[model samples]
Target: MARDPNEPMPDGSGCALQEPFALQVLGADMEPEFPDKCVVIIEPTEFCRSGMYVFAEVEGVRWFRQYLRDEQGRERLVALNDIFPAIELNGLDWKVLGVIIQRNIRRKIKTYEYADGPSNQPHGSINAVDITAS
Candidate 1:
């Protein structure tokens, strides 16, 4: 993993571990998805990739959307769920936050068995199983 150019040492007291950036989503800009207050994670040396979520800083505003690459490898950050707003010329000085690995929702998923019931059961499915937990 790449470390940030400027980061203080972490002691028992505490450490500024991961770099997190907060973005205030606006207007159908990224609607249908990437709602407002979508906290994005930005890791050091993590460049932008087409069709990936990135926190792009343009002018004085920051935007979160799925980045798209053109034939020439040029990029345009676009929202999959929205089309009214389109981002163009994606090579500008944009701060790329880490890709959105998951989403936050209030809905609960129903399953037949508890998570530990079966290995192939859906109810008790576990993501990123811990070595210690197993």
Candidate 2:
């Protein structure tokens, strides 16, 4: 049997259910952008727009992908790497868990901020900064 995606996974950290959290990228599915083992900060929100790197649940499986909503109103979860096929979300049971706001790659922090309205870009304005210095 598959686990219910709505139910939160236990981390034993005792973090608040609705608070922001960090997750380590486990695969190259989102590679070139979010490389394997990179840490990402997720901001829990009920409002998720297009062009955001989002943590979502689809068909009982949790996924981290770029959320896309086309002009025809079709929705999809796309991997940054082309090796993975995009997940079309027309009739599937899916929900956005949160939007990735920051990514840490070897002490370099890349911040992602979405515009107030819809966007055609895959990722909105990004600002990268090195935090290696104290």
Candidate 3:
């Protein structure tokens, strides 16, 4: 694929570098864990482990998948959804752009609560604010 000279290439072949950015998940390739429209935080310099979620570029195409090693000790990309076939990376030119640190699943309302300790809350009751109620 042709890349714009002004825009930085994700392959790291160009001098331009990219910073941390947000990418919205699409399709069922990474369903359940990374549902559709869920925003993922990508840190360009984050270290990627064997089982960590990563943003990788393969064959000039970008994808969100789990990084894993195959039985033959070869690196491969596995989709959370079993329906999608895993990509064996024996001959592909791939680059790990970043590791996904966090994800924001959109819900009705975001809530949180603070308490002194576990004793401050009632048994089997959550201390979180119910601001969703109007």
Candidate 4:
């Protein structure tokens, strides 16, 4: 069967770089939740809110971190692990490239979906679950 030209390939082959892309987690910065070597699918979007795992570019350098907005509306990029210091976006030039929507650990697929309405969780928080293949 022929594949769709617009669909993103697992290996990123023949797909537009601007579209949703898969990237391998390289460090323990986002450990526990997103372990090293795990593959994450990033959906390009400009409408990122608080508490979303996002791929962003800061001062010309790209990073994968959790987007955060404090009560006062101050924004920052934080690592899941406490060891890594947070990147405050108060006066920095930053742009969110995409939000992580899926993660693949080993052969298990874990999906991260945003909540629809108001909830106890933070705004734009994700609900992650393991998706079993039948």
CA lDDT scores, all candidates in order: 0.48, 0.84, 0.68, 0.87
Q: Report model 1's TM-score to 2 decimal places.
A: 0.50
- Residue range 1-134, candidate 2, lDDT tens digits: 98788997886334586788999999999999899999999998756877788999998899999888888999998999999999999999998889998999888887777766754444543344555556
Q: Which residue runs of candidate 3 sit more than 4 Å off their true CA positions?
A: 1-18, 107-134
The all-Cα superposition gives candidate 3 an RMSD in Å to the true structure of 10.5
Better of 2 and 4 by lDDT: 4
Between candidates 1 and 4, the one scoring higher on TM-score is: 4
Model 1: per-residue Cα lDDT at residue 79: 66
How do the residues 10-122 of candidate 1 rate in per-residue lDDT, one tens digit apiece? 54223343444433444555544445444333432256545555666666676666666655767676765655566776556665545444343232221111123234422
Worst 10 residues of 4 by lDDT: 116-125
Q: Please rank every candidate by lDDT, starting with the best.
A: 4, 2, 3, 1
Question: Which of the two, 1 or 3, has more lDDT?
Answer: 3
Q: Which stretches of candidate 2 lie over 4 Å from their true place?
A: 1-15, 118-134
Candidate No. with top lDDT: 4
Question: Residue-wise lDDT of candidate 3 within 1-134, one digit each (tens)?
Answer: 87678985566554335566778888888887678887777777535556667899999999888877544788888898899998998888888888776666764332322223234221212233334445
lDDT (C-alpha) at residue 125 in model 4 = 59
**TM-score (C-alpha) between model 3 and the true structure:** 0.64
How well does candidate 4 score on lDDT at residue 19? Answer: 84
Q: Evaluated with TM-score, which candidate comes out highest? A: 4
Return the lDDT, model 3, position 79. Answer: 91
For model 2, how big is the CA root-mean-square deviation?
Answer: 6.9
Total backbone collisions for each predicted model: 3, 0, 0, 0
TM-score order, best first, reads: 4, 2, 3, 1
Clashing pairs in 2: none
